[model samples]
Target: MTTAVSLQNVSKSYGEFKAVDSLSLDITSGCVFGLLGPNGAGKTTTIRMIVNITVPDSGSVYIFGEPASAKLRSKIGYLPEERGLYKKMKVREQLLFLAGLKGVDSKDSANRIVTWAERLKIAEWLDKKTEELSKGMQQKIQFIAALLHEPRLLILDEPFSGLDPVNTSLLMEVIRELSKSGVTIILSTHVMEQVEKLCDEICLINKSRKVLAGRLRDVKSNYGIRKLLIAFDGGDSFLKDDSLSVERFPEHYELNISSVEQAQQILRKAINAGAIIRKFELLEPSLHEIFVNKVTGVDG
Candidate 1:
């Protein structure tokens, strides 16, 4: 497997503050890689280095194994968090400008503009001024311009911010299709659920440093506790078993057993309490939960 992006010992500081402190990460080809962190956690700084918009103070950023160069930027599509387009320019003209900046020819650029605009359902808005469009409409156009050249690596910062759920799902489909066609993506967002659904792997950053990085499945599996939720219609005293560390709800108890055999024993204990079990199920730790656990030391 080839790497689409690699950062090694990358560090960026602003006077007394280090925005990105010794950050290193690898994003492979043909998959969505998530950069998960809270605001002010250096995600945007790292991305800036990747795109060469901001040079790293003491590290290297390699795009496709070459030093981050302007020539290689054409192969990279970036949708920045702050949307930037000429407010007075027509959508089509703006996309054309961006395409030309990336060294795309006029005819081919126009063709791709049309194709992407139509696919994004903004074909009719091409001739209109960008300022005339609503925020969501403007976002759709910006997304088209970003991908008009069909770049192999996409760096999207908070791509789902302005879109409604319908449009969010729509763009998610596009991202998935891009990945299926071997376009590597580096996504940055605070939305953990989106990462859970979209990312193949993830690197979690905290206070300008990587706290976790691995395959998504491996991260989740390793971070999980095999806990179960059981709703039994009785007092908490019924579940005072030595094998289970059970917590009680208003009318039921959530049980945690060390093993599957212990779960069976818990079930029998519930029955012996002369209580009816309502909802009994295993619970998996969500990415949001894991993140809070790792970052805040709040794992329970």
Candidate 2:
């Protein structure tokens, strides 16, 4: 596979603080790559550099195997975290103007706008002023604006924000379809559940540094299965064991155990305490758990 984007020792700083420190990444073409990090971890700064909005103090950024340049911006579609749209402008007019900036022909851009608006179920809002729409509606419009030019590399920052569950699912489906059509996407968001479902690979940064980067499945496998889930009805004495670390959910209990032997021991204890076990299974660590552990330095 071709490398869609590459960064070599890229670093960016603001006065006394380093926003990104010696970062390096290689995103494959036609893949959904997750750029994940906690707040103020430089995820936004890194993206700004990729789109040529902010230049790195040292190192380099390459897009589609070429050095980053203004001409290459035409191939990239960026939906920034901070939404930018003319509130007073009508939806159709705003989209057309933005598409024109990308050098998309007016006729072609208008047709594409209609296609995306219908596909996103926002066609009815085309004639309405941007300010009259809700935040979710505005988000959909911004999303359409990004797609008007049919960019090869799409970078979406918190694309699911402000969307309800139904709209979120709709957007996720659209993203999957876009990926299937061979569009490379860089998804930057703090929502780990969505990332787990949508991303093929992920790079996690903390404090402006790379902490984890790999194929999603491989990253999880490397962590191994360190947790177990048990559903039961009876005495909860086993959960109080000092040797066991546990999280209590409404339907089940998640226990962190090191070995099969330890899990078996807990099962025996639960049964002995008159607990009727309905479900007991060893589970791989979830992306959410991994994110928490890595960000907090608990995994180290």
Candidate 3:
């Protein structure tokens, strides 16, 4: 597979603060890549540098094997974290104008806009002013605008931010479809569940540095399955065991156990304590758990 995007020691600064510090990563073509980080971790700055919106203070960004340049912008679609649209413009007109900026023909843009709006269930809103739509609806409009040019590389920053569950699912379905058609997607968001579901690979950054980067499966496998999830009724005495470090969820308990033997021992103890186990399973740590651990420096 070709390298869709690459960063080599990219760094960006804002006055006295360094937004991105010596970051480097490669995103493979035709795959969904997750750019993840806590707020203020420079995910947005790195993205800006890749799209040439903000020049990096040092190092380089390459798009589709070439040095990032303005000429390449047409091949890339960016849905910024900060949403932008001409609020007073009608949806259809706004999309047409934005697409024209990308050199899309007005007629072709009109056809595509209608097609996408219908698919996204916003066909009736085409003539509605942008400001008249709800935030979620406006987000859909921005998304359609991004897709109008049929960009080979789609960079989505918090694309699901204002969406409800239904809309979020609708957008995820569209992203999967785009990825299937060979569009390389860079998904930047704080939602780990969505990343776990959609991303083929991920790069996690914190404090302006790369903390983790790899294929999703490989990253999880490296962490290993040291967590056990068990749900039970009756006595809670089993949780009193000092050897176990447990996190209590509303419906279940997640215990950090080193070995299968230890897990079995816990189950036996739970049973002996008159607890009726409803569910018990040993599982690898979830992306959310790992994200929290990594960001908080507790992964070690």
Candidate 4:
């Protein structure tokens, strides 16, 4: 139950623009915490403060309850949205350089590099210059560099960007393993599905302010079980119900019901309309829907 990262009333501004306004959030130790928001929502600014890449104008940032410092940064691994590595340097050499900055010794650093490279299936490309690799390949290398020191805390901004599904799955498996081994992770990404899968807790920011923060289950549950998924065959006439807000899929239709009574009415109507019901269930609001609801003021 210890706090891994804390931002207390942190604020950052660029002249006339306030990038982060009194933003405060606590990320628990040994869990994946999703830092979510739409574009220009101050997510990157907040993360920059966490890693001390940019100092906050006011308030404070603490890692493991201590002030953020250069020495402390050795224990923190940060992967920014922009990929940075020596284009002319070999993969091994670049990783070694990054690891050295974190105070990792050559012997241990090389060992971890080998381990991670092999695990990520990038061992074959270690001898290749970074410029020779594909974007997805480069992303894997960045991931390896981030963990080269075996950091206790990992902050990844848009980690899955430009990755093919195969590589994305590979990275996700490693992330899950890291979480299981008690490494605290702060994930900032626009991918809501990934957040739903990986994050235990979340803090949503909007226009440089905190709009939502808490356990994911509790947050979704608070919105109530208003979503319904129904699979049917034959007629599509049942979808004409004006009271229902519907989203169509090839195999099913997702409908918004006001209450349990409404759900029952929907089922009866579908049956009466000659549609054979194959599946019917009540479901919680998705993080994507919740985020859209909070940030855009649209019904989730």
Candidate 5:
């Protein structure tokens, strides 16, 4: 399998503070890789090293099978947490300038910009100054600018920030399209729901160290608790079983089963106890659950 990016014992420090520890990770080509961690967890530092914004104090990173050199930089489109744009420049002008910096021709950049703008329904604002647009519109323009150079890998930090739900969904569609067309993406965000839905693989970092890394489904199953949530018309005593622990919600009760077979057995017991079942679901631990467990060091 081809790797889009690889980090081997990568670390960074400022004076006495180690920001990123000896972190080893791999992002496969043509996949949306989620890089997750809480704030001040060295996410930005790792991204900077990958983009060559800062030299790592130790270790190495390989981008597309080569050291992260100047040439490889062009193949990466980075949308940082801190957004930057020349406030006075027109939307198209700023994009064209950025594309030119990446060795993109004016004509092709213009074509790509127009296509993206039109698709995103922002063709009307191309001539407007960057500062004149609303935050959402500006975000759209900035996103287009990132894609204008057709970078092979896109690094987006908090990509959904400052957008309404509608625009967030719109950007999600665009990100999905980009990945489908063979662009590898490293999506770093605190939003676990987005990561759960979009990422094929993930790396969870905490305090500059990797706490979890693997395929998304496998990681969930690895850290998940076997449980089931059921709603039925019966007294609370119906849930009394030695094999399960029950927690009550307003509308239903959650049964923490020791095994899948136990869940099935619980259902049979509920039926036998004259319960009219309304909702029954096997509970899979969400990204939030797994994240809390790992970061809190609560395996038991």
Candidate 6:
């Protein structure tokens, strides 16, 4: 397995506060890797170090086997959480300039820009100033700019921030295609559902430390069968058990159970309580559930 990005005991500090502790992580090539954490958990700092926007105060950051440096950074495309664009500049001119900075030729950049804009359904807006577009439109433009040079490593922070469901699905499909084409992506987002659907591996950090890291399947499997989803009417009375964590919906309920024995017990109890069970099944722990548990220091 080739390594796309590697951090060795990396630490960063700002004034008296430590932004990142002695953290070490490896991202494999051609995979969509999730860098997830709650707000202010060193995710942005770590990404900055990887893209050479900020140097680590201690230890090292390596990209594609080379120490992160200006020369090596051209192979990286970074979309920061904060949106940045020359609001006054035309979208075409802005993208051409940014792509040029990454060593893309003017002719090639123009062609690629047209291709991307068409694919993203923003071709007609290219001649307009970025400030003239809506937030979602500007976001799509920025996303296009990031890939203009076709970098090997893509780092996206909150890539779906302003997108509606349709555009969000479009972007997700594009990201998966990019990964299939061998572009390694570092996705930093608070959206757990997106991480579950897109990422092959993930790392969770909190308070400047890693709380979890592994292949997505292995990480979820390690937690065992602890969740149950069922649809039933009149089962609300049986859900009063204090030991179970229940999330109620109009048509179904999700319950957290300890074991198979506990699940069977709950099923029987619900049935005997004059409830109709439309569906019942054990479920794998969701990424959101795992994230909340880890961050809150809750076991199982």
The candidate maximizing lDDT is: 2
Each candidate: what lDDT? 0.87, 0.94, 0.92, 0.91, 0.89, 0.93
Candidate 2 residue lDDT tens string, 1-300: 999999999999999999999999999999999999999999999999999988899999999999998898889999999987899999999999999999999999999999999999999999999999999999999999888889999999999998999999999999999999999999999999999999999999999999999999999878744899999998797689777788999999998987889899988989888999999999988999899999998875
Q: What TM-scores do the predictions have?
A: 0.91, 0.92, 0.92, 0.91, 0.93, 0.91
Per-residue lDDT tens digits of candidate 5, residues 1-300?
A: 799999999999998889999999999999999999988999999999999899888899999999988888789999998897899999989999989998999999999999999988899999999999998898888888888889999999998999999889888999999999999999999899999879999999999999999999898787657669999886657666565677888998887665788778778888888889999899888898778777887753
Task: For candidate 5, give the lDDT.
Answer: 0.89
Worst 10 residues of 1 by lDDT: 251-260
- Cα lDDT, model 6, residue 155: 95
What are the per-residue Cα lDDT tens digits for candidate 6 across 267-291? 8998899898999999988999899
Runs in model 1 lying further than 4 Å from the true structure: 224-226, 239-268
List pairs with backbone clashes in candidate 1.
Answer: none
**What would the per-residue lDDT of candidate 3 be over residues 221-293, giving only the tens digit for each residue?**
7874479999999978768867779898999998897788998888888888999889999898789888898
Task: Sort every candidate by lDDT, greatest first.
Answer: 2, 6, 3, 4, 5, 1
How would you encode candidate 1's per-residue C-alpha lDDT over 1-300 as one tens digit per residue? 999899999999999999999998889988899999888999999998998889999989999999997788899899999987799998888989989988899999999988888788888999999999999999988888778778999999999997999989989999999999999999999899999999999999989999999899988777646677887565556676575677767755666545677778777877887778888887766888778877786553
User: In every candidate, how many clashes are there?
Assistant: 0, 0, 0, 0, 0, 0
Q: Which residue pairs show backbone clashes in model 6?
A: none
Off by over 4 Å in 4: 231-241, 247-252, 265-276
Candidate 2 positional error at 230, Å: 2.1
lDDT of 4 by residue, 221-280 (tens): 887547999998888887886666899998999998768888898888888888888999
Checking candidate 2 for backbone clashes, the offending pairs are: none
- List candidate 5 segments past 4 Å from native: 238-245, 268-274
Candidate 4 residue 199 C-alpha distance from true site, Å: 1.2
Between candidates 1 and 4, the one scoring higher on lDDT is 4
Runs off by more than 4 Å, candidate 3? 231-239, 248-252, 264-278
